[model samples]
Target: MTATATEPSRGLAARDDRVATRPLAARLLSRPEVGSLIAAIVIFLLFMAAAEPFRNVANVGTILYGASTIGIMAVPVALLMIGGEFDLSAGVAVTTSGLSASLLAWNFGLNVWVGILLALAVSVAIGAFNGWLLLKTGLPSFLVTLGTFFILQGVNLGVTRLLTGNVASADISDMDGFASAQNIFGSEVTLGPVTLKITVLYWVLLTVIAAYVLLRTRVGNWVFAVGGDAAAARAVGVPVRATKIGLFMAVGFCAWLSGMHLLFQFNTVQSGEGVGKEFIFIIAAVIGGCLLTGGYGSVVGASLGALIFGMTQLGINYAGWNPDWFRTFLGVMLLLATLVNMYVKRRADLR
Candidate 1:
């Protein structure tokens, strides 16, 4: 009995950790989004107390609409950052996508769908190109994407001028397939008392897909591996190149979708638009639990981050505060969030 009891106890102690359940606190701390979630709740409560308009059910759609726009881009930006890369060009890339599609559809008199399809191809290719270049040259992604950002920015301006003789692309509202495209990308959906832009639905769907991929799929493992340590992952047979490149393409694809929303909604393209927007996307991802160091993040957290932004941005206005202080407020939130995330990460690591 003594021998048998000791053997079983030893076996239990040596149980494979892969199948072992972590303590609840450890598990909770391990989630990147928990800190952000708490922050979001705090902010929401503060706004609900300070601003009567914020408490109105009618404003729910407006808040979600704002969140969805940033959330859409935040999802992919979170993924790319997870893969240890940055796309500074992401902002201008959205403008490029809209401008390209609008210019082609109008100038050629082709169906709007044709330009959209072609733009998809171009956008994906641009992402692939960024990946390929990074792999070949071994330069930092920030540098590579920064160059692309400037190039695309200039092209957006120069080409729009060249084609339309104006700073913006011609309105494609009357083009063939315009209505259909608008219905798909720009329409609003009514949900009982709240009506929301289609992007809200898209944002939620994208987050679900990204979380599923990051958690359930082989691709997700590859992403974590590459981000954590590329050289080590490569030695272990991870497709680092493909994974990183694919991540860039994902960002490109999201940028395309966001651009389509802008295009279909407004029926016009502003060449100078979207500049400085990449930082917002990055900040959202960072707030969501993605570290600047790469390899650790949560898509759910990122979406929540976008929600925080939406609430803060609109809540200030609803509260009758000076909107000019928005930047300062954003800075405060970012700093607080970073500190909270860092403390959470350290606690998780200790556990």
Candidate 2:
């Protein structure tokens, strides 16, 4: 063969070889997310088999109701984690935001919409303060957020006790726009034999939007950059500080949403509400594919993680098992997921 002809033939063979190897490489590098998803499905099926009551439509609705709050909170928490920071106060923030809105509307007779705005504003302030503290002190996020968590926890309890003299929640039914808010947050619309709560449907919608924002947008790229290496990101003009601060605000805002829904749904609150939820939110994010070290995660994966929790919570009860085991189950799941995440991260780092 002529040299030129031989070169072209060799090039084609090399191209074919590259194509064949690409998919294999991708499969190997793929994290445990796919496996986790499959495991989630298996868990679901197991619940279905052993828990006959779980198969009922009403029970399904209950799970959805439970999952909604957790899933909603998980979205922004996952985003924040992917951006490389954690918000330890996010759990208590829920109570703060909820109480803010409820008290404003019920005590001062502020319009529901106005009260909501104020509550969100409070959340933003707290979130921004968290970011500012982290940036200024060069402290680890864990310590920063732990401080915020304690402060907020105190504020939630102290303020509520001083004002209401009871752990029961403030009611805003008399506030304007209360009906509309209820329709959005509290109303349930049925589909055939399946009853659906608006919160669950809202969760599904938010998950879709959050997933798109993370996986298919420039902001998503920024999230990874900021989380992976803030110094490098800032050096490259990626607005690392702004991104991290903004993510904290987003987490706060989500807490507000969850709190608002809770206020409307239950029409009551306890000072202790949401005190232990921060870890749960993080767990859901990690289980979904978020890395503790940041720069890697999927929103859909986080949502799935919430579903797993929701399933386990209800499924166990339906299965007639001791509810006390949930704590143990959560501990096991967290350990397993963390180990898997660490393994995947180590392999990627080596490459």
Candidate 3:
């Protein structure tokens, strides 16, 4: 009787262990990150089925081309949001950096490397300012970054105009660093009849690196801690301030990279470049499963979100629809995704 009972107990424990493990696996698969990826795939399929041009190699390249810079920024932005902060000036800062690069190269006749370094330095400074204001004033990041956003916006346009006397832009192609920037951001590869911009490959590589760093590194652990609870993270010996500031700087650096691409790919730096993209980055981050309050997000999820944006941007055009309606479509999609994410998050928290 005792042996039979013990055998049954052991079987029950084994079953229970399996059951417990299953939920964890399921939970991992069902994370908000996974959801964003599903959304991207679903959107891509929907477009491919409805829009003939959507599946073409050319269109795919464009989708990725558009996604690259945004995707790059989205990773770190998601990190920042997960860390319970915001950087509203991020998009405008791209314009600032690009213009700075252009002016340094074209106007001042500086070496391209110097111009690039200057842009990066300025970006880091802007990021440091944002972090400082947030940490010192105890003001909400929304207000702080909003102020910075407007300031950068004005600076981007105002300074560019004052320097060039034109509303459009300055040409940086003749500059010394042009070759290197073009090599990195403007590289192209011939694939069949279509040319694939190699920056798309760069975006993919960056995404993989970002994902690995986010999911596999100790810094990633600290990122979660800071985002989950700043005070708690600090109490537990995490360098909350440094982590937050570093993330902001990363966002700035991404902005610089985007700026570099814009300067090379387009060969012009308009004062209006990257205007009104801050919220879009935030939207992508959120749609990728980032919490509005921070503490949870995924780089892959954010990249997928950027992919959705790119697909939608091109898909609507391929569907024989007015491209002007793209903003409306994006807004609606964002609203729905945010609602779904919020609902799912609340449900998970309850459980």
Candidate 4:
């Protein structure tokens, strides 16, 4: 009896040891962000070695600033994509928000804060309308949001021209609350010899919050389930409509934040400023390991993808290459990322 008991204990210990000694490569490969992390490191090292200006601290700050601007929106876009929906209107919606804030304050003579609040409300409403239309009509989100994109685009250009007799809004830097708003959204913080935009902090904070919501909360489970199979999720009592609507609103909220940043940073917005940016957001999401089919993605991955974008945008300039080549680089990155993501997914499934 004693011998048998000792043998079982030994087996248990051996199993525990095997578990403890599992290969680190396996763990790393299991992460959705692992591919993005690798890509970021490779690109960083490449740019560091090849582009002299890329090594400068100030230039690094600029890269981070650019990344933050895109990352801030990318995170929410990733989440919405994971929830199995698209927002084609996201880019124009951002322009709409900024223009709303500027025109509301400048044209209506309201306080800047009021304009900000109203713009946020309008943005959220647009998002809600998109979500509602998708559910009510059982139509594809792509079509719904595409319609919204054009409508918002037309409104932006038409209203701006109608009001200002130009395609840009009047300057709002001198408005009441402009100083405070700028400090919150568009100000800079000095670290050592580098001045970084506040948007970096916002980007990081938003990523943390989104990651937590995705990984540690019930709603996160719902998000994944809904994205994976909306019908099954609904059958299991998940509030599919609410979850999707909430996701869209989250995107809207981020857009409002980004819009505020743009307005405060420049004090003006061209009606066409954000056109075609929706594709960039989608590409970033794809590069970050979010599947086009949804149900799998990480906010951290999306952020890293944005970082890669920022690096490439500046790195090429630092390398003294033609600016037009940027699109070619983006296409290549997108294709490679998609293939890697597919391979990773297949491996995970096999495991």
Rate residue 15 of model 1 by lDDT. 93
Deviation from truth (RMSD, Å), model 3:
2.4
- Name the TM-score of candidate 1: 0.94
Q: For residues 7-68, could you state the per-residue lDDT of candidate 1 as single tens digits?
A: 98789777967667789878887788998898899999999999999999989999999999
What is the per-residue lDDT of model 4 for residues 128-166, given as tens digits with 9 covering 90 to 100? 999999999999999999999999999999999999999
Q: In terms of lDDT, which candidate is stronger, 3 or 4?
A: 4
Q: What is the Cα-based lDDT of residue 179 in candidate 2?
A: 88
- In candidate 2, how many clashes are counted? 1
Over all chains combined, what TM-score does candidate 3 have? 0.91
Total clashing residue pairs per candidate?
1, 1, 3, 0
- Candidates 2 and 3 compared: the better one by lDDT is 2
In order of TM-score, best first, we have 1, 4, 2, 3
> Which window of 10 residues has the lowest lDDT sum in candidate 2?
27-36
**What's the CA error at residue 351 for candidate 4, in Å?**
4.1
How many clashes in candidate 1? 1
lDDT preference between candidates 1 and 2, better one? 1
Q: Is candidate 1 or candidate 3 better by TM-score?
A: 1
Mark the regions of model 4 whose C-alpha exceeds 4 Å error after superposition: 1-22
